[model samples]
Target: MIVFFLAIAILITIKIIWVLCATSGQGSFDREKKEIIRRANYLTSMVCTSPQGLLDEMPSGIGEQFQGEWALYTCSMTSAALANIAILYPPNKELSIKFIDQIIDIAMSEEIREYDKLRWREDPMDGIYGNLSHISYYSHLAWMISRYKQIGGDGKYDDLYHSLCKAMNRRIRKSKSLNLPTYPGEYIYIPDMLVAIVALANYSSQYEGKYSTTVDMWVERAKKEWIDKETGLVASFLEAYNDSVQIVLPVKGSYSALNCYYLSLVDSEFAKEQYDCLMKNYKQGFPFAGLKEYHDRTCLFGMDIDAGPIIFNLSPSGTAFTIGCAASLDDMEFRNKLLKTAEIGGSTVTWFGKSHYLLANLALVGEAIVLAMRTSAPQTRMRNK
Candidate 1:
């Protein structure tokens, strides 16, 4: 009984600290923006690039398999990292251009060419195939086309983007199992759907009226398939082989963040629902409190570089990635909470009187804040008008 009471007290104390740190109105971290840029640039430089510009896999200390056709995962991180860098420091146009150029070169490489040639055997047949690997590739490519259009390298990239969209569409059409396009076979999972929706949406944005209907259809399908009405959180996947699309239960810590981030793009009701669900279900325990892995009955907690280190019982990687998504979505409350959590979790390391994680988080946070402020700022009228 004494131990239980002590645990309760600890939880309460942590929550209080989180609230205080998050709600502090001075925006104490804003001044650290330059450091943030430097750190992000450093990290980006380390994880990405070979002589040819293709992204290399970060060493997988966790259970993540880097050897498979899943080599595409690195590109996804590169896309998100590059997009974040562009958003934070637009002045560094040359660096951004270089990164994008590298990515394009990699996509057009013999390795990718070889993968494309053998995709039939190597790929999953269900619509849900390719999982995170494919999703990362497509999402990064789409984001580059949509968000970083100014850094256009050559007409070849435009063609590449269009070709990718056409290929995805062809895959969807071939998997005629569902009324809406499935992944490859019958797999209608959440992550795949999220990536597909974002890719389609980005492509449609480029073409405007030309692909608007297609974009809308994919978004609606995501809404109908992945979202759980009861919990308001999106499920991980819908099993293809099952008679009915089996909805996996218990929302994932990482999925919550990714779902919210993706939803911000289309501004669908599903996004709002997922956000609300995240707020409702988030517990103060785990990394902020004391656990490493976020294990529950439905989802098992494990370490993957993408999922981050699972400490105590919480997945740090998931939390960090989720924080990025939350920031991208402009959820100030969640963003603040995530920032505070990072502070407590040792995500922000101090070196020579300078904070590391805080710098990275601030850059990301600044981008989100600036985007939100700009969008919400009241319009001013010119005197002449």
Candidate 2:
């Protein structure tokens, strides 16, 4: 009788934990895709309603130094999220156009314009070039404009688009590291290298040139120097010129997953090799789902700015973003598994007719990844009208 009653108590305890941990709608994970879409739209709306207004609402719990540079990284997330929404989802002409135009406004300028009460970082290089040209801030804005303009049939942004592209090219041509330092004098971050490569590739495709040659060289350089001998994965930080490893990230899943995703956009074959290596080494299976973050002793080394709350070395942010990567790479199984993990981690809250993430909120970047995952699948893309 004691054993029987103990079994019942244990089952009740498990059910309660599941309820508290899981999201709404039967509080289940796998079936929460629609909720994911709604949550994504909420983040998109934060941009759509005001465009540059996100800057106004800065100073959210993160450190002051990071909050100052919020505009720089958020711009990339905003463009990637909004561009897909405008292109693939049902057209919200007014909303998408306003968002795209504001992105153009930032892209065409020397620096993001000072909003009434915002605290954007004002470093000397804060102009259109940002921290470095190769890690060009304008590149993302340009790509977003180009994609939206193609879809929206408005030549309104054409000049600005070309100008931003030229800005990126100018910076690339003058850069010494080929990829410049992520910080003015600091080391180069591999993820930024992936972004710079995509930006260049997108520009070349639109204008037609063999940009692949440069990409090929960058890939070879990384493989030859940045990759660790023990593990076939990239070191997180590398010397800009010689590509020597400054910091070995080891097989940390949060970075490897994103690094895998971004690298794929520029060089699919190489990115695939990286992705395969990451999965073989870092992908961790749980009872409910899988995580893409680190599982080794390297997990003890303390988290970086991007890796949020590294419990057991599994970052909520990294695992969340990998969902979009999986969708882009057409790995639906992994994508769904990651979504389940997200759902379990995030809770559903609605306000003003939109879903917002609360209780372990995934933040803007994670929500952006959710949008990318939904839109990247062919079925969700806006039909070319």
Candidate 3:
């Protein structure tokens, strides 16, 4: 027993040292590039094996619609992560682009879109020129294509990209609250709407500022109406009806962190302000340095699918998404600390030249989010412009 304990201690110490060295930002780019390739390869193989597989042991109570949504998230997030890897490490560009294309095609397929189609009774792409309220689906699709274009992929999806941007922009421009529903009649998730804006911003930059005015107006208006004064972070859910906006769930750290990360793509100054506010209000030091799910530490907020499991006042999604925000804003110290925390908690294992999180039930999804977030450098978008 003593010998086993000592061996475990030695391994833990070695891991801590490894994390420190990796985050030192000196000659780490090569290491990161290699790591991205490994993770990307794992994701590519897993998705290729079963593009729409659910978690290993999902609850029997969950229906097919939720299962489809989960699969869609896995596909889109993985593709986006691979796209980032393609941009950050030029050598992996061709293979990464191929992987992204494959995953994104799955995301757009009928198997993935069945849930949206079931809800709306039509194909998601059918209303490309109309108010298709599937913001999450279309925004992720558009963002993936934008990233694909950034890395010199062929223009096969150029028309789809333009139509998505035009549709989202038209909806936002005509809305009273300057936001669109994530679903047909559901409330607006600020993070999802921000993604639509980011997609439009990227599209506008590529073109000649065609949707620039719409993106600019939404950002200006959101700064006034979307911010929660108490936490000074973006509200997670809001309902727009009867020509008025009602805040549903306020001060969600997970959504706020995600919104800031998306905002960094277009508005650095505004994103920085929200990032600072998030650090001040939601950042926690003990029991793993991460963001709390809710602003009030004393308040008990439990696990949810969106925020993941919250343990000891720490939120998994909030912490993971903040990694991307920190990298985007160039906050290296905090980024390194978060990276250290993830290394300590994620139970990462590298085998056969591929890496994954043993602790994550949705291991591929977690790996995808982390790879995309950890590689969130400014050059991903800045150079393209």
Candidate 4:
């Protein structure tokens, strides 16, 4: 049987060579994926920025006007686009800096200020205005600025960041009911507290030594109150009654996105809890089966512009955005599954192509991929011993 043994050894040698060749070829495959992502990023950036830059028709009016809301969304879209670009392509430092300036300019423009005042009242066309109380606008602005700072936009927007943090803190304090801030009460549905938390976290990261206590207090309270113990997910709202805080029912994809944001501020344990809960209940074909398919079920059903169109039993917004965060944390299985879901969902666009789909889709996908890359990359953490 010596010949039989020799034959087996020869086959094993061939297999080893095949594996080596495959391993060596991985660089080319990675280059290809990078190129695809780069192209997608370029496409998304153009779609988000071009509409406003090229528009010759500027809307007229001051506060609570249709023109003001349009400008707000436009600026919001531009800010999101620039943030995604900055994260994805660190090499494009000049472009990112310019975009940050553009975003700030847009925010400071006469039109936004007028609209800012209208947020608390009702307008003729748009109904109630200023429901987000500058928190939403400033949160996005803070995010863009923080990203810029992370990518070397230092000392440029420090004052703006400080102003935004103070404004947000004041609003939060004013809105707090029974120690838990009630966000947007009735007129708007956007999760303002989550946005505020993310913005505060970025600010804290920037000035940790100086603002450690303040940051810690906010982060700790958010972790304790907002996070749901049973599901390990953060609820959208809290009802205040007799100095007691009660969790609001019917969690949503928007809240899922916020969970990722909140997790970024906390430690790995919090993230793991959220990940386990999402996989067990929110994902398709898990213990919470048919959630991805149900459209009318408020708790699980998806199809908002912010959430994007859920298709084939999947929450596009929830899955796509979370994948990047999961990837950054080295949750390979979740990342891979999320990437697959995005590929499947992203490929189904037929109407306005990628440009017609909401700007968040592209922005979220790009950010997720970039965050995944960052999580995988090695880094030195500066710890005070």
Error of 3 at 279 (Å): 0.2
Span of ten consecutive residues with least summed lDDT in model 4: 376-385
Evaluated with TM-score, which candidate comes out highest?
3
* Tens digits of per-residue lDDT for model 4, 1-385: 9999999999878755644432232222133244334434443354234334412123232223444444554454345444444444555556756765665665555545455455444321232132245555566567666656765665877887787776666555555431323223542232555555666766777776444445466556656776766566766556765555577765665456546534544445665666566666566744222224222353334355445465555665566546534543556555554444343333322233222123333343333332233232111121110
Say which prediction, candidate 3 or candidate 4, comes out ahead on lDDT: 3
The CA lDDT of each predicted structure is: 0.49, 0.58, 0.77, 0.49
Q: Candidate 2 regions off by >4 Å?
A: 1-37, 49-53, 59-61, 90-95, 103-136, 210-212, 241-251, 292-295, 298-303, 359-362, 378-385
Q: Against the correct fold, how does model 4 do in TM-score? A: 0.65
Estimated TM-score for each candidate: 0.67, 0.75, 0.89, 0.65
lDDT of 3 by residue, 141-210 (tens): 8988887887778898998898888888877878888887877678788888888898899899889888
The candidate with the higher TM-score, 1 or 4, is 1
RMSD of each: 7.9, 5.5, 3.2, 10.9
Off by over 4 Å in 3: 1-28, 53-62, 299-301, 360-363, 379-385
List, residue by residue over 1-385, the lDDT tens digit for candidate 2. Answer: 9999999999878755764544334222235446544665576566444434554545466744354345545556666656665554444555666666665565444434332113334422345554334343455556666556645537787776666666565665466545555455566667766776676676566667646566667777777767755557776666654532355455456666777777766666777787777767767665445454564554533555676666555676677667666666667777766666665656445666577555414355555555555445432233342
Query: Model 4, residue 312: displacement in angstroms?
Result: 4.1
Ranking by TM-score: 3, 2, 1, 4
Tens-digit per-residue lDDT, 237-305, candidate 1: 566543345665555666665666666666545565676666556434433632122334323444643
